[model samples]
Target: MPDTLASNPEPAETRSRASELMALHRAEKLLTVVNVWDVISARVVADVPGTAALATASHSIASSYGYDDGEQIPVDLMLEAVSRIVRATGLPVTADLEAGYGDPGETVRRAIGLGVVGCNLEDQLKPLPEAVRAVEQVVKVAEEEGVDFVLNARTDAFARGRERDPEVNLADAIERGRAFLDAGAPVVFVPGKLTDEQVQALVDAFGPQRLTLIAIPGTPPLARLEELGVARVSFGPLSQNVALTALQELVEGVQRGEGVPSSMRVLN
Candidate 1:
């Protein structure tokens, strides 16, 4: 059967509690947003005693399906992956619905049905107005559903070939960030090309209370991000790459008659 977010939807109390956990990250000292692809990874991360929450990596999901990222996967497939992840863990799972999948209102309704307490919507692939409209729809749906869904609005200006002109890129990011916030996004994620000064500037522009900064891949270390007043840090597909590298090494070692590393041996 094709996978999808549950049609029945979660109970009101469950949704509220999930939203609360997402909201609490704002005040917490550190929040590690790990990227998970499948139910196994989600379960493992959820079992981590100190993990704040879980997030899906669009690239990882797309790669898994032999496709490129950026809305390549159908909404049903994405929602199914999300549902499996939610079932694998008790913690809040943030589905990275690239470009909100389709119409904003329908996307929000479908996401909420999957029991997601948070989602990452990006403006890299869509026009600013369309992105803003989508965020607005998401906010309305979240509010009506009585779930404080954390909307992490991502601006891909820096990620999409705007590295040469720092000033222009930064300005674009700020403008997009502000638009999303105005449309009801509680967090602004500037993915890529964010320097220390740039990060601080975004924080200054948006303020810590109103907008949380989400750090993307290769941005900086968690300590530096915290120093910059970033509220949340995400590794995106880095963790998955690390996992792939480890597996490759393990396989190569075995093929070379080196045997598996003792550390990798089953505990039984």
Candidate 2:
């Protein structure tokens, strides 16, 4: 006999919530995601008002376990981390399934089983054609499983410094974005600091509602970003970096015979 879940579609409530989660990016306001790598961070972010969704940062998650990013961590271990994050929140959860780990279809199946309703599948080191093919397979599996998952296809040309000329990089990103979108990805994510002109060009070419970019220190503010018509804005590993940097400061201070600062104190 077929497994009940495999045969039967997701419950209406689950499906409705999934749809609502996907709709947040299409709204006028920017959908800001503070990427988390653990249950504690997941709980903290989910409790904040106006958080549309939560996504796991694969780099941070790998770092937490003493592994570098780029699929260094095993897929099972990564999905276990994702499961903990999902258990911490009722809101939609998206996992950064970096390059789909190994097999995108299998990775997505495991992600869906863990209650994830969305994912960021990056191009990573895969060539443009290969990335598009992977995206197509992931979408196919998600639809077959009746998950209706939000597949956010990530392009890493700019972030990885693939091309010498910035124009060449931008052109490649746009081309990949089109292919991914055509392959059934709901959004295309380009992570890196892009100039205002470059950002505008991506938005205009890709359609603002389907373009998602990582937020950086000097990028335009949220209000300005919304005006620019971006679908989503996310901090890939910035949150973890900020938190760790503060703790590192405290550790150094303690080593220097100085007590923790008042601002750093934890109340009982």
Candidate 3:
């Protein structure tokens, strides 16, 4: 038998919110997730009338601290950002807890303590077996905590192999994804801009309700993903890129002696 995480299940209110976020993945309409970096983006997204929930993008959040992704920033700072965002809204917030901070047990405890109901646990640049073990630890603690936490298992084969070789074998993705799920991951997020066929293959291998896709330009539109039966779609760092690109353009215009766009100019 598994050890109890929490003597009692989550409070009624926390359980209700967690269940609703979990249901979004099983709903008829595709769950479109907008990944936020900080409180500003989080609040803006949370205020959207049609938004379902908020997720954090580690890349964006890390960059906000002048660091590259992949745990470049300290775990303390990262969780602090998560805490602020988690506190800013009534909706469920899941964080991109990169690589479980190298300790799945403590990671689970800290995440729950911060009021997060879900999180993405990546493979942490380790072999499949190691990642599976980490996932097991996380799942064990989560169940004991009785928070109904949702773990989105992320496979980094595409990213891990990009520097050495751009080729990402679908077989590797399948093997890792299945291993994680069998270890108790509720969702498998296959990142990168895979083809419609590759995306479909993932969904077929891991049921629509269990597969999560990271959206990119090459991928089909949001509606098409729904038609193809994906469970969740995330715009990881894309929103941040868009926001930064606009600011870059504004700076360039200023450098060119062009006045600020009237739309953004403050009128005293």
Candidate 4:
């Protein structure tokens, strides 16, 4: 049977949400995303006053379901969790689709079907031509689906090249990021524990509001990023780690016979 999803018209609201997400990346202020894992986290973050959109962390979602990161969770299972989150709120969602579940175009088609208007598609250090072709495929799929999908194409040069010289990693990231942009990716995601000079170099290469980053321990401050014209900053799985840390502390306290803290708000 032919797929009805591919033939049907996309919802107007989904198109609008996609546009909104794209604008957030181009805004002067850095778009900060505290990545969510499930419906509860989605709702909690969506209710925040300034949260313009939500992003999913693949690592966090997989861990929540007892699966490892890197597409360890079944693609169908991941889609269901993402669908529940999409239904939980009206905010636009950009998912972390790690390596595109081994089929970049098909995975994005499924995500678009579930109301995901944007995604982070990692290169995983694939050959340069292969990675750029993946970005092109994602762009083509989004165009076919009739949505202005935000493709945050990620290059793992810095993440995977920590053992190499800093200059070597910087050049590689620039080369890959430029190719990804030329292939129609809206922004390039360069994730790692970056130094201030490294961030500036990337900004210089990609120009203002074209680079996205992950927030790690040594990353530059948000204000500094804004001054350098970064498009977005997201705390990947660390946000989930923070939440889990609190949960662990509460459980330990209760084990010592303490009651629930009086300051908790019933968000859910």
Please name the candidate that would achieve the greatest TM-score relative to the true structure: 4
lDDT, model 4:
0.91
TM-score of 3: 0.89
User: Order of candidates by lDDT, top first?
Assistant: 4, 2, 3, 1
Model 1 lDDT at residue 153? 84
RMSD of each: 3.6, 5.0, 6.3, 4.6
> Clash totals for all models, in order?
0, 0, 3, 0
Residue-level lDDT tens digits of model 2 in 1-268: 1111112224454466568768897887888999999877887787778887898999999999999988999999999888878766777888999988779989998878777888999897477789889999999987887767888899987988754689988998889988999999988999988877888888888887788888898877777778888988889989999889988999999999999788853321
Q: What is the lDDT of residue 256 in candidate 1?
A: 93
Residues 180-249 of candidate 4 have per-residue lDDT tens digits of 9999999999999888899999999998999999998978999999999999999999999999988998
Candidate achieving higher lDDT, 2 or 4: 4
Off by over 4 Å in 3: 1-11, 163-168, 262-268
Model 4 pairs in collision? none
lDDT value, residue 232 of candidate 2: 89
Q: What are the runs in model 2 whose C-alpha is more than 4 Å off?
A: 1-14, 264-268
Question: What TM-score would every model get versus the actual structure?
Answer: 0.89, 0.91, 0.89, 0.94
lDDT per residue for candidate 3 within 101-165, as digits (tens), equals 77877986887877788889888558878989988998898888777778998887765666544
Model 4 residue 59 CA deviation (Å) reads 0.5
lDDT of each: 0.75, 0.83, 0.82, 0.91
Which ten-residue region of model 1 has the weakest summed lDDT? 1-10
lDDT of 2 at 229: 86
